[model samples]
Target: MNVEFINPFLVSLVNVISTMATMDLKPGKPQLKNHDIAKGDVSGLIGMVGPKTKGSLSITFEAPLILEIMHKMLGEKPSSINEEITDLVGEITNMVTGGAKNLLSDKGYDFDMATPVVVSGKNHTISHKSKGKKILMPFSHEHGMAFIEICFEDI
Candidate 1:
């Protein structure tokens, strides 16, 4: 995976979470992911396709972290995963992907993003469409942890 591909997502994640949820996230080291099982309780996945490349990006959040984010964003935090929480996950995925898309576009990479899909469970699976290498970036906030996974390849 190209190292250049990872920066935009990191920048976007920090920007989106800071602006919308008013929370500061400390990013941990990014590593190559070897499994399909999600690291968090909830995940939002979206695909990106372009003339030159195709890929997927997923954001997964632990229950406590997501609940805190929901509280900050909507002023009401649910006790557990629900429709509204899932919707917020989708929205956050969309925004972060959109922001990264724009940054990549500036570098001459054009892409069309599919609607984000949200999934929640104790140990859910995340199936990224692309066969590219999956890079996992973990982030920690005051409440708990979240993860961002990216997989991209030339098609």
Candidate 2:
């Protein structure tokens, strides 16, 4: 992925989501995910395929952040990971991907996005073609910790 093509979406998506959710988020240095940078399970993923590239957008969070986000978004305390919260994470990932898709499309890159897939665990890495650039944008609310990773390859 060209950094120029990818960075705008990363910044824009974080900006849109933070504004809508009323949270302040900053873009931490993005790097390719390797054994060193990743922590817990990856929560949600959405794949993108364009004329010149293919990649995926993923969202990950610590358990506490997930719980707190669920509570705040749903107006109830969540004691455990349920379908609802997992679904929300997936939807959020999809929304972010959509934002990227729209931006890329406007730049004359036509692409289609796949349905988001959500996963749970403590370890797994999102890998893409080593041809372009890999980006991992970390975000945190004053009260919640979350990150979104976007990986793309230019064909």
Which candidate has the highest TM-score of all?
1
Per-model TM-score versus the true fold: 0.93, 0.81
Pairs clashing within candidate 2? 52-155
Candidate 2: tens digits of C-alpha lDDT, residues 10-83: 77657655654555566676665653364545478787887777777678776666776666655776776678
Residues 90-148 of candidate 1 have per-residue lDDT tens digits of 99999999999999889887899999999899766676666788888889987988889
* lDDT score for candidate 1 against the true structure: 0.88
> Top model by lDDT, which number?
1
When summed lDDT is taken over every stretch of 10 residues in candidate 2, the lowest stretch is 33-42
In terms of lDDT, the poorest run of 10 residues in model 1 is 122-131
Report the lDDT of model 2 for residue 68.
Answer: 67
